[model samples]
Target: MADSVTADPAAPSATRPTGDPLLVLSGVNKHFGSLHVLRDIDLTVHRGEVVVVIGPSGSGKSTLCRTINRLETIDSGTITIDGEPIPAEGRALARLRADVGMVFQSFNLFAHKTVLENVTLGQVKAKKVKPAQARTTAMELLERVGVANQAEKYPAQLSGGQQQRVAIARALAMKPKALLFDEPTSALDPEMINEVLDVMVGLARDGMTMVVVTHEMGFARRAAQRVVFMDAGQVVEEADPETFFTAPRSERARDFLSKILTH
Candidate 1:
């Protein structure tokens, strides 16, 4: 069976798209002491778009995702999500985070929490959802990720794939307007990679407004609306998956593609 998400563009919500992008980064720069990790970055993500970012290790892909949620602060420029500029700190930053969910490469579930608890904790504490209400919503998200059967189990009791699914469910419980995935399947065993990718592919098909950083070529080709090729802290090329795979425009992109495909 195919795995894909299907979101209705006409869904009514006060915070829904106004034909403006859900995410925008303009002239963004980030530095770690003397090292320039990201520079003059400008990008935008629309309401229902899936953008896949690919690059060699240490090429700033992960740092870029971090900067979006302010996990790694930008030294210059700005990041705006859902029409609000990302505040530097305190309540505003926390509120912005609640609107943008993130899935890390390592399944970062609380070891002591059950899958259900992991999913509900954020909603209850951050969103002020009542316990009963949070549990119900958590179950719905767990079911959506096909992990309802494991909802009562601790993260340690589940396989890597199961744990990753729970991580995804936890992110979704926040009802985020956009999702950031940082190599979601990179740490999984080879045999378990597909299951997690399947869930992500489903989200993309549904138009969840995602930005994913991964080296999964097949997933990029089949599921992404646009593929961004980055190298050495810069976006070298951006194209639809078809052209990105077959007709890369930049020399850096072409070189990167050759190494990736030849490996």
Candidate 2:
């Protein structure tokens, strides 16, 4: 149920010397019945790092994101946040989830709750923050995401873009150490994509550690310190955004870029 795969035994235990990585995945592997979803994945995300994961459909990009937060349990692998291994269940897992926020493509907001209520719920219930303080934090996050004016509105009353921004605000209210985004803008209309991306860019600039699964190369170019390319459940290449876009080392990555970029 748990294991680790290291690139080199001689390498440092953690990714960097300054401090422990914000997130670490060692020899991570997962499967669903007969299908192998992630294979020998070794990745490390440091504090303040913005890592963008890009891959073709069915390549396990979203699975990779989900596993980081234990939404999809790995068959065998170790995931650590802030130097501690993730627990399999119970209060420990809940605490880990609070520390690692996630935003999905569907903008999973509570339709029955107002925008402010949606953002405050998690902080109040899970984080045990006082109701008044939770509301204050929620308002600040909504304003930060540029949707405070819609605080009283329900999810159904907002545009897809506004709803997604509310989702982001909800995640921020948790004050997570890192955020995992599963194609955050994929479901939005073309006109709405930039609004969401702008908030994400601001978060990156503010030094929010993030692992994003997205095909939006423009966002990657502008925001990512590193770009990871995955294919068929394995990471084929990783590099700085400039090099990844201009001269990808792998043929798979080159072909992917060609197809996605041309259109």
Candidate 3:
């Protein structure tokens, strides 16, 4: 079945705590020399939840997403995934990264590798899966993302949407417990945005816990269970998608929605 927003958008759905949170952050802070990029951030992502983070440029939305996987380190605060504290480095960090998959705005595929190779490379190298096993898994993921037909093509040969879908497939091949999308559709042409979004929609429907950083309001409304609004390096407000769009409590959130939704 296609992924869908819960019926009755106004109905509240509390953050599910079926067990321990799959991802958690508390008092997270990050600074770039004199610039404070993230300020006292706290977030919890439960299993099977889809949370979309949205805000103006320089609002720290992307930085927030990066910290979850330790792509960017926090100066303070603790982050834990599946009840384990984030490791500082070495094999522990590598294992943590394997459990969390990240897709960047850039497709970041090896220019020389075929789409199939791009998906299988990490599985074979990092996870130490056998080549034949990795190939079968790669083909299954490519089919899942709707790009099995283009498996033999290089990144340069595919459209931006197709390349991003391959990127998603590559991340999924790792069999991560959660996925993070950093503006996955920002680089795509308008016509291609929906194609990438559709693949993401499918992943959400299949119960992949996801945190997406994007300006795609329609996807945010339709797929996200919770909408987080950030401003000036702080989480200004967070609410269910319907309430966030229709009845934002903070003036900053209201102004942001006005500027984006009107245009």
Clashing pairs in 3: none
How does candidate 1 fare on TM-score?
0.91
CA displacement after TM-score superposition, residue 80 of candidate 3 (Å)? 0.4
Q: Give the per-residue lDDT digits (tens) of candidate 3, residues 1-263.
A: 12112223234453433334789989999999999999888888889889999989999999999999898999999999999999997888998898999999998988999999999999998999999999999999999888999999999999999999999999999999999999999999999999999999988888899999998988987788888888888888777788888888777888888998785
lDDT of 1 by residue, 1-263 (tens): 02111122343421134245889998999888888889788888888888898988988999999889999999889889977899988998998898899999998999999999999999998999999999999999899899999988999999999999999999999999989999999999999999899999899887788899998989987777777777778777677778778877677777778987884
Question: On a 0 to 100 scale, what is the lDDT of residue 253 in model 1?
Answer: 77
Off by over 4 Å in 1: 1-19
Writing each residue's lDDT as its tens digit, candidate 2 over 1-263 gives 11112124234421222324889998899998889989988888889989899989999999999999899999888999998899988999999999999999999999899999999999999989999999999999999999999999899999999999999999999999999999999999999999999999999999899999998888998988888888888888777788778977677888889998785
Looking at model 3, how many pairs of residues clash? 0
Winner by TM-score between candidate 2 and candidate 1: 2
Worst 10 residues of 1 by lDDT: 1-10
Question: Cα lDDT for residue 153, model 2?
Answer: 89
- TM-score of model 2 relative to the true fold? 0.93
Off by over 4 Å in 2: 1-19
Q: TM-scores of all models?
A: 0.91, 0.93, 0.93
